[model samples]
Target: MIENIHFIAVALLIALGIYTLIFKRNLIKIAMGISILASGINLFLISLGYRAQGIAPIFTNAAIAASEVQAKMVLPAPQALTLTSIVISLAVTALMLSFAIIIYQKTGSLDATKSRRLKG
Candidate 1:
């Protein structure tokens, strides 16, 4: 049940991001939309490894002995992957924004169609 909800939310986020990226003319908005799409993908991947009633992956002596841990524990790999992806996305977004700002300064406009330095 909860998984379905998460899937739907992620889907909507990706869809909106793509729409913004494709339809928006401003370079900054397109970069922001790409970031949104990356975030949605990260969320979706993280949700895949979620266990309903599981505890954290910390291995305490008491927790180990108590046997309260569920057999269906969430996988750590997906979480780590998501974190790495988010960091990479942040770096990419910053780079894109910096470039966009530079372009705007040089072109005096945010619209991508206005910046044509390579046109022959």
Candidate 2:
């Protein structure tokens, strides 16, 4: 089913991100993996609120009564949470990249192992 495909894709993203985080030595790659992981979580949250032929939970002047709309409206909580997560992810990504830049400047390499050796 199409719904199952969405979840499968989300799982793939999460798996790939974790693999990258664990295996990649580059700081940038690790940051990208974190970003990808965040995206998967965001997608999963949004998908949880999906409904077939569901209407928006807005107060538009459509040909439907408020009571009827209540039954058909997609859950708004997931959507709001997704938006908040997006903003938080952006901040985290920015902070991570900035730290990567600083690390590269101090250690002259982006490899995680090399950077650790430089710390002592």
Best by TM-score: 2
User: Against the true structure, what is each candidate's TM-score?
Assistant: 0.87, 0.91
Q: By summed lDDT, which 10 consecutive residues of candidate 2 come out lowest?
A: 111-120
Worst 10 residues of 1 by lDDT: 60-69
Clashing pairs in 1: none
Instruction: List model 2 lDDT by residue over 1-120, tens digit each.
Output: 875888998999999999999999999999999999999999999989998888887777756687788777888999999999999999999999999999989888999987786453
Q: In lDDT terms, how accurate is model 2? A: 0.91
Using alpha carbons, what is the TM-score of model 1? Answer: 0.87
Instruction: List candidate 2 segments past 4 Å from native.
Output: 118-120
The parts of candidate 1 lying over 4 Å away from their true place are 1-3, 62-72
Pairs with steric clashes in candidate 2: none
lDDT of 1 at 67: 53
